[model samples]
Each structure stands twice: as C-alpha cells, then as structure tokens.
Target: PDILHQLVKGTFKDHLVEWVGKYLEQVHGKTGTKNILADIDQQIAAAPPFPGLWCFPDGHNFSQWTGDNSKALMKVYLSAIEGHIPDDVEHTFHAFLEFCYIVRQNVIMDQTLAELRDALAQFHQYQEIFRMTGVCFDFSLPHQHSMLHYDLLI
Candidate 1:
C-alpha cells in the first residue's frame, strides 16, 4: 500500500501532525498554543547530534514535508510531545511510530509481525483522541485504511 507515501508520510504528516496542532489549539487558546508549539519546536531543534538524523530548527513549521522528512521527524517527535499532550494522544503517536519502524524492517520475523499487529491495534485504539478532540472528524482515510492490511502483506 505504498508504505512511504501512505503510511509514513500521509499518516504522520498530513494526519497526525495536523491533528495534534489543532488539538493543541483546542486545549490551549491562541497564546498558549504559540508558547507550547514553540516549546515543541525548541525540543525538536535541540535534538542531539546524530549521524543520520537531521535537525529541524523550526520544528515542523517548514513549508514542505517529504517522506524522508516525516520519517526523520518520527525519530524524535514522540519525545517532544510526551508531556505537552495527553497520555492517550502521546501513546497514539508512539504506536504509529512503532508500527512505521517495524514495517520498515527489511527482514520480518514472526515475533516482529506479532509486535507489528499489536502496535497497529494500539494506534487504532488511541487514535480516537483525534476524533474526540474534534481535531479530525474522520479517520476513515485511505492511508488509515491501508494500514489495516500492512501486517497481512508482510
């Protein structure tokens, strides 16, 4: 199901990030949103130097987001949003990142497949936060639908 564009890029950037931003604004008014988002940006920008990881000085405020950019952001975003957002919301992103990384593995074992299934389940469960928060009205998106088959495909 075109994991790169559908699962990684679409799910993470188009959906989750956008939903989280809206959720933040919903919970915190305009001013609070700015300060909280700035804190997230600072956390992202301050990510320690790593060989392959790229830094985002402006967090996810960039104009364009590619598959690579989303993948890189997944590496650090969970930590950045840990305390700022609800535990359910944080765990939803956690499950998503876990699912994405597990799917990206070149060689898949049965145990990993089980883990993949569990992560997907957790993601679906916690993702209700978006709907409940009114950040997103529907999650019946093609990319989300595609995720249902990822475990079977592997």
Candidate 2:
C-alpha cells in the first residue's frame, strides 16, 4: 500500500508524463534514449491523462475487518502485501507501461492486442516474485533467460 502511494505520488504521475513526451518523439520519428529523454518535458505537461488504477479494489472485507488493541491481524496482512498491490492492477500497469515501452521501441511504434497481454504477464511475474520463499533468488540474468525458455504464452 505504501509503495502504491509512493508510486502514485512519485513515479506514475511523473513517468506517465515522461512517457507521453517519448510518444511525441516517436511520432516525430525520433530514435535513441537521448531523443526519448527529450520528451520528458512534454509528457509532464499533460497531467492525469491516463485511465484507472493499476491495482485491485480494496478487499471486500476492508471495512469489516478492524484491528483490535493488539492489531496483530492488521500487522500480518500489511506485512504480507509488502510493497505491491494485488496482481491484477500490477499487471495492468505493466501492460500499460510495456505498451509505452514497445511503442517507443521504434520510430513509429504501434500498440497491438498481443502487446497488452505481454505487459500484463510481465507485471504478473513481478508480483509472483514477492510470493516466493526459501529460494536462492537471482533476479538479473538467470531469471530472464529461464522465463524465455518456458513456453508460457504471455
């Protein structure tokens, strides 16, 4: 929840704007990271331009569940969530972010249905990582290579 809050205030608001600027650069047939960086200013100028939350609705029991003086249950649930929201929204945002990335990947990038699903899966794995336990975690190269090896259609 805190991560969500920080993202809302920090990255999401700013990144979306930066992404828009990149979009414009792509529209004008720009290339390279520096050219993409040029769009940051324009993207920031457009505020609240996107749609919907990138997380799930607060749980159905959110209101019904209240903490007692000990507040143990609240502590447990909060700890479990760590820094991420439910998989649904995370993946949605992943899709949205990926669409922005791939579109700008080319001088004249376009969005496709396949890309949308791929983005969702990208975020899904991101969320799944948090659920892992008792494993020697190496997030850099091995994970990326192994993910590709699986015939999982994302």
The candidate maximizing lDDT is: 1
Q: Output the lDDT of residue 15, model 2.
A: 36
Clashing pairs in model 1, backbone N/Cα/C closer than 3 A = none
| Alpha carbon lDDT of each predicted model | 0.89, 0.34
- lDDT value for model 2: 0.34
- Candidate 1: lDDT of 5? 88
The sequence of per-residue lDDT tens digits that candidate 2 reaches over residues 1-154 is: 1222223322333332233334334444456434434333223232232443121132212344222311222112222222323353345345435533443343332345356447646644553433252121343433233334222332
